[model samples]
Target: MSGVGKSTVLRELGLRGLEVVDTDDPGWIEVVDGEPLWRLPRVTSLLDRPRDRPVVVQGTVANQGALYHRFDAVVLLTAPRAVVLQRIRSRTTNSYGKAPAELARIEQDLRDVEPLLRAGATHVVDTSAPLPEVVLAVERIARGA
Candidate 1:
């Protein structure tokens, strides 16, 4: 999912005046027991407060599932394996999938993890579409459309 256009789309949404949070940003995630997880208190407090508009947050991690009930929509952004790997290789925003091991891990996740995410998703959008279409679809989801 790293290359499925989450950050780019989130930036576009922010430009359009939507509230967006990329939990991959620092201070949002912490490693515990060798796994990266969202900082519970911070995210919980964030969702606890009322807001004029929906806050669309992008993240892919094991522990996030526990908070799904608090969200209005659980969306999974997906792309084909080749597209995902290619985007990962070229992306400048993050260096996650550059290494051989990381790419392999991502490939594994694609096979093992993504399906579970799909099953739980209220909506699933394929990012192989044009960027505008992907962005629009996600924006609509964020807006509760």
Candidate 2:
């Protein structure tokens, strides 16, 4: 799930002139004792903008209870397990799934958290498609198409 192309899609949306907010932005994450804690208030403040156009907020933190309901549409990005592992391993910006213990945690998240999010998703996009296709699909969803 960590490597499901959420960041790529968010970037593409921003390039296409969409207002994008990435909850994983530095200030939103407070690493306490090596564990990253999402600042819900900061995230909520970011989400509390005027809704003239859809604001695409990309992050795994949307699964936290009622926050999922605040969005007009919730798009869940998914990829095959192998693809996810490969992407995580290849990523240079973040060291999330690199260590053995982190990889185990990521695997467990795939098994545990993903299913619940999938069940609640308004739209589920498979990110194994070409980047353009994935971006197009997400754009359509964000536009309520």
Model number with the top lDDT: 1
Question: Residue 46 deviation, candidate 1, in Å?
Answer: 0.6
Count of steric clashes across candidates, in order: 0, 0
Q: State how far residue 30 of model 1 sits from its true place (Å).
A: 1.4
For each candidate, the alpha-carbon lDDT, in order, equals 0.90, 0.85
Residue lDDT tens for model 2, 1-145: 6989888889999999888988777787776677666677877887886667778987765435558767778888999999999999999988889999999988998999899889888889999999999999999888888
Q: Give the clashing pairs for model 1.
A: none
TM-scores for all candidates: the values are 0.95, 0.86
lDDT string, candidate 1, 1-145, tens digits: 7778888888999988889999988999999999999998888998998899879988887889889998999999999999998899888878998889988889999999999999989999999999999989988999988
Worst 10 residues of 2 by lDDT: 60-69
